[model samples]
Target: MNAPAPLEIIAMAFSLTTLRVDGSPTPALCVDDRYWALADIAPEVLQPEPSRGLMNVFGHWEHSEPLLVAAAERLASAPPLPAPHSLEDVLTPLQYPRKLVLTGANYYDHMRGDAGHSDWDKESKAPLFFLKPPTTTLVGPGRTVRYPEQTAKLDYEIELALVIGRKARHLTLADAMDHVAGYTVAVDLSARDWQRDPRHLVKFDLFGGKVFDDSCPLGPGIVPARYVDHDDLRLRFWLNGELKQDAHTRDMIWSIPEQLVAITEHLTLEPGDIVSTGTPAGVGLATGQWMCPGDLMEAEITGLGRLTVEITK
Candidate 1:
């Protein structure tokens, strides 16, 4: 497996309230694994709207190359993190994404599940996908996930989410990555009771079960595409202190290129749009176990950092 580059270009969004350099919240760039806060670096390109947050940095696709170039030059010196900001201060890196597209049964093992349908074609067909309400499901690391009262079975799905840097419509497989801004780790939280009903066999609300407020937890931060090898990263999930899901990106039935082509075929993907590649096997639904209040869930990807979410009643 080819590994990610040693120099992972990471960045995040912090609560302007929490990033007060001098008793007043300021828009600053947190980079290099949150160790350095490049205060107002390329503010014209990164922080056009001083009041808005990280999405500003991602929305300007035309400026991404230049911004990343400037960021890399600044990162060379390895400046110290500012006194006012802490990792705990980080917010969901990109808030209010225009859309959240997700692939379904994209992994062979995950598709197999317990029922083990052997005839399910793994190839020769386009991927099946679904959409989720964007900001309503989005939260960052260290955020608390309220267990919805509607369902008893809460599940977790760790997926590699792509951040679209440029507008794309009817894109070919070869041109897909050119539209990607970077990548981040995402937990596609689900309430399985809404997904399927084995007893009824007729009613399945996978759409409703898949999306709920605060159901998607993303971050630690976004890693620039240059520093990542998407096809071979290790992904793992932990429940409490025990490891639950472990897999590599290479196992994906449909590659990122293929998935992107499938999505862009119908939807015009825009900057700040997120497309989450599906999760692998080992979700709670397979084991008949569910997360409870006080449970801590951790999802980690090789180059991208770990994302943690706490369960609460």
Candidate 2:
């Protein structure tokens, strides 16, 4: 008998989301508002790659990216695979990242206008970062962000989230892009009132404000980097249909490679770890508006996708 047939390899691009099918994580390819089960569309490709969920796909992105893309290219013309589901049925692209790193005030307008720090000089200063308790902070699109009772000052921030594709440590700014796999829209929800230490034992409590339930609403899906313009993508946010923060990646104080260099200097960044670049100006504290219960938040990064998360008590 013949041993087996080799799988055909080709690279295309599609946004990768996940669905809860029969109690297991199933990959779904998001084509606009519709989502098709990846297993149904490309069983041959899933055979070698992890079909479990989007998180696992990052581990094998080198081979998976192309294979999945080749399969996704036909989505527009292909017949229904059993049938596709609406965006409401799928989960965020990733949930359990090993680390959820966030940049603090990387956007120029955010720093000078919203954060009220005009003296920050990127040329002479290092980048700032904060880590969220991801397991609790992360929620999928269409999910609800529970407004914690601890703080009355809940806020919304829209940022470009980067999905790491390879293990990287001490990489130069020029080589940093090679390790990034994809991009997603992440809302860095915050509790402006709780962001400080009441006890005054420490400088601030970034977690106290940011670690509430559903603090980080990430993804409609992750679009592979090859499919997007990394340097000049637009980042927009909407609160209850009112556009709040509208800016571009060009406004960021530190470049993606700079952010990675800042992070990798402390520890190694592995595949599946998340790095949310930073939010633009127009946070509640800046605009004199705040997120309330029942408010809907939408975050969008150009060429990536939009993520909608409802706020609730």
List clashing residue pairs in candidate 2: 11-66, 12-69
lDDT of 2 by residue, 1-313 (tens): 0112233321334678777666566778866556677777766545554643566678767877776777777876766433324444556677577899999888888888888988867888888898988788888866457888888888888999999999999989899999999888899888887786576457578878777777888887888777767778888888899999899888889999999998999989988889999988988987668778889888877767778888777
Model 2 worst lDDT window (10 residues)? 1-10
Give the winner by lDDT. 2
**Every model: Cα RMSD to truth:** 3.9, 6.3
State which candidate has the highest TM-score.
2
After superposition, the stretches of candidate 2 with alpha carbons farther than 4 Å from their true spots are: 1-13, 22-24, 44-52, 76-78, 81-88
Candidate 2 achieves a global lDDT of: 0.79
Candidate 2 lDDT at 304 equals 76
Model 1: lDDT of residue 20:
38
